[model samples]
Target: MELENVIDAAVEEVLGLAQGWLGWDGRPVVFDGNAWTPHKSLRRVTDHLVDHLAEIMCRLNGLDPLPDHWHGRTVTTHADFARFTETDLEEATSRLTRLALMYRAGLRGLDPAVLDARPDPDTWTLREVVEHVAGVVYYARAMS
Candidate 1:
């Protein structure tokens, strides 16, 4: 399957689970050794997409990707404790769907050869990055 389709499918899975958060009871669920709330799961998924999207754009532009300082799965902020409202669900759907579309368009526009090019020895190829982002579906699934 095309990498963009794979990413969109994964994001769609998350979006489906996010709707369930509107009924969340504000209890913390532990998954993969980290505490998860509905908000935290959504935040992590969004952040992961944005972070890697930036990395892909930066590398394509010949600029270094900025470092991400997200504590990711290690600590939950006060905002993460907020109630998951219908408005929040709408916002998540809007935000994540737009990001998914951006990823799809951006990745589809790249030449197939570009997917195999690495920006640095330590960095992953663009193809691998998309796969990693697809793996983030686990975060939303954990909330389910």
Candidate 2:
């Protein structure tokens, strides 16, 4: 389907899995040889969403996309190993839901041709970028 529906579904799916992580034992699960704790997973998911959302906005506004300096997922921080709390879940839900809604509002109507067109020769089409962002659902599921 469209970017809005795809991203909304992925966000809800991630949140649903996150709801069950209150009992995590401060252990990380490995995926593709990368360690993922609850905090790390949540961080990756949100950061990925925000990064691409900002990229899309910048492109739409005809401005260059500013760099989002991320940790690049290679090093896990001390914060990533902290115990996950109920408040963490609530905050994640709020942030992700709001982001998904913003996607909906921002992309509600657009020319089909424009969505399929690359913002530049070096970049993916906007639709492809949105699909990649939706893949953040992998983070929550990795803990399961």
lDDT of each: 0.87, 0.86
lDDT by residue (tens digit), candidate 2, 95-142 = 999999988876789677877997558889888888888999888887
| TM of each candidate vs. truth | 0.94, 0.93
Per-residue alpha-carbon lDDT of candidate 1 for residues 13-120, written as tens digits (9 for 90 to 100):
998888878878888898888889988999999999999999888888888889988888788888998999999988998998899998988887788789998767
The true-structure Cα RMSD of candidate 2 reads 1.3
Cα lDDT of model 2 overall? 0.86
Task: Give the worst 10-residue stretch by lDDT in candidate 1.
Answer: 104-113
Candidate 1: list runs displaced more than 4 Å.
none
Q: Count the backbone clashes (under 3 Å) in each candidate.
A: 0, 0
Question: Can you give the lDDT of residue 131 in candidate 1?
Answer: 94
